[model samples]
Target: MTIILAWYRDLIELTMSSNLMTMVQPGAFSNLIQIGVLNLRLNNLTTIKSDSNSITNIQSGAILNLPKMRELNLQSNQITDIRPGTFSNLPNLPRLRLSSNHITNIWPGAFSSLPQLRWLDMCSNQLTYIQADAFSNLPQLSYLNLASNQIATIPPDTFLDLPQLMKLVLLNNPWQCDCRMVAFSLSSAEMLTNTIK
Candidate 1:
């Protein structure tokens, strides 16, 4: 029985890391594997699960086979955009890292299916605008980072729907501190005293 359990664990791990076509050992199966973790960081991937209309051939189902995948690290790539419903099937996805990419825009409902997602890291990108209601359905999201982008202004109600969000980072953005910013400054000053310092 112990040997059987060990084999099961090995199979699970193998399934999770199967989508990575980089450096797997010989005789490895690469599909329908349900590994708990999938880390494909720092690869030369220019797109994330692209589609037929996409210029790149990386389609949506590229990582769709790993159903048990809970965490995915796709940092330091050249991803420019994320199609809506790109990760609709991966129900257990809890954490996603997409930092250090070239993303410029995020379509609404793009991250809507990630019901269990708690943390999202999207720092160090070229994002100039975030469409309204982009994160409206993320009820379980707690930590979100939108730092180090080209964002100059935040649209009204852009963050109002995120009631469950506990920690949000909006630093390194060249914010235009005008009347709109004054309202934010006053509200932030009153809510979090650290804003004064």
Candidate 2:
């Protein structure tokens, strides 16, 4: 605990001085609502927060107070689960990176608050299932990368709300090219066409 506390305190000093922010925990910056960019990449973190750490564990409504946070990087962690609406507090968040994790499922409304989200990277994950309308909240989303995942099928209306999507990457997945898939592929093509033209 002392080591973690020292690390957390160092992060605050570095961030306040406008130097570089890394290896920092979310609870460490919970009170800094207007922080512009936060990067916690390659931290080997498994959970969003832990209750034992008094200085950095997120309290209730602590995340919601961060109304001005824009970019967050949590890539290369051991994160496996994302509680629904956990990210729904950052309505102004634009860029989010969750690549190279063990995420296998995405709960519905997981990104509901990120109305300004532009880029979302979930590559190199174990994602095999995504709840319906899981991405419906990100209406302004543009770039999405789901490459190197375990996705076998894409459900209907999975991307209905991503009207502003510019680039989509779904490569390297074991797609089950069956009847439903054929139909889904055709429908996806149509949807893309409609979105483009």
Candidate 3:
């Protein structure tokens, strides 16, 4: 269902948390052009993509038409997958919170839309494996939280493209500590130590 917010032209922040929203049609917020912060946490959203085939003619994602958005909160939802172009509209977005979801897979280039994104929180999810290029194309990312997931091992070059990354939280995962994890662990240890210092 489309939420018509065309009258509130000067609206900046919109909070619709804990509303039991199942799905948001594409261009749901197309009228909220000046909006910066959108909080849709604690919903029952399974997938951000709408069921309409017309979405292909527009944008293929949950959030659309909000160009000025900086912070998006979609935590505590039932989201399972993050497909490519899911966030293709929010170029200026800086922070995204997807924690406490049922996310198991993140398609490649899922986050390539947010060029200015700096902070990403994906803690407390069901993520088991992450592709090496999953986190690529994020030049301004600094803080990433992947704690409390089911991930055991990730590729050594998983964080290679994130030059500005200063903090990475990977705690609470059942790590294997095998040869494949040696390089990543050593580098992560150094990064964590430097962050502490």
Candidate 4:
């Protein structure tokens, strides 16, 4: 469905949760220049791009023209894949919630555009593996939650890009107790120690 918010030029927050929306046409929020918070939780959104059929594959310019966007909530959806440049349009977004979705894979550069993001929640998803650069380019990201997923192991440098990351939650996952896990544990401890200093 097309969401024409042209009349609400000065709108700051818009919540379209539980709307059962399957698709959102491009330029849906083009006129909401002052918008900061957008909540699209509990929807049937398979793809953020009108031309795509995959879940959560947000192509560039799909939801563009929101220069002031800060918080975006897409929880409890059928999102499975987080393609690269998904949030390229929301440059100023800080907090993103993708919990309780069907997310299985996070491609490289998926969050490359969100330079100012601080908080990210991906709990209760189907994430099994994450690329090393999936969370790259987010220099300001500090908090990350990956609880209740099917992840078994992660790349050693999976979080190497997040220099400011302070909190990382990975509870309820099938983590393997191998050398990789040992390395990750040591690195994480070091990062936390630095953050505390």
Please report, in order, the local distance difference test score of every candidate based on alpha carbons.
0.63, 0.67, 0.80, 0.82
The sequence of per-residue lDDT tens digits that candidate 4 reaches over residues 63-84 is 7767799898888878888887
By lDDT, rank the candidates, best first. 4, 3, 2, 1
Residue 184, candidate 2: Cα error in Å is: 1.7
Model 1, residue pairs in steric clash: 15-33, 16-35, 50-58
Worst 10 residues of 3 by lDDT: 50-59
What number of clashing residue pairs does each candidate have, in the order they appear?
A: 3, 0, 0, 0
**TM-scores for every predicted model:** 0.73, 0.80, 0.87, 0.91
Candidate 2 lDDT tens digits, 22-122: 22354545555456666666555555542121111122332444567777776776667666666756778889888887888777777776789999999
Displacement of the residue 67 alpha carbon in candidate 3, Å: 1.8
Give the Cα-based TM-score of candidate 3 against the true structure: 0.87
How many clashing residue pairs, candidate 3?
A: 0
Off by more than 4 A, model 2: 1-27, 50-64
RMSD in order of candidates: 7.3, 5.4, 4.0, 2.4
Candidate 1 has a TM-score of: 0.73
Question: Could you tell me how far off, in angstroms, the CA of residue 90 lies in candidate 3 after the best superposition?
Answer: 0.6
TM-score of 2: 0.80
Instruction: Give per-residue CA lDDT, model 3, range 1-197, as digits (tens).
Output: 54567788789998888776776666677678899998878878765553221111112665776789989888888877887788888899999998998888988888988889999999999999989888979999999999999999988768878878988899999998899899887876665566567
Show where candidate 1 strays beyond 4 Å: 1-30, 50-59, 180-197
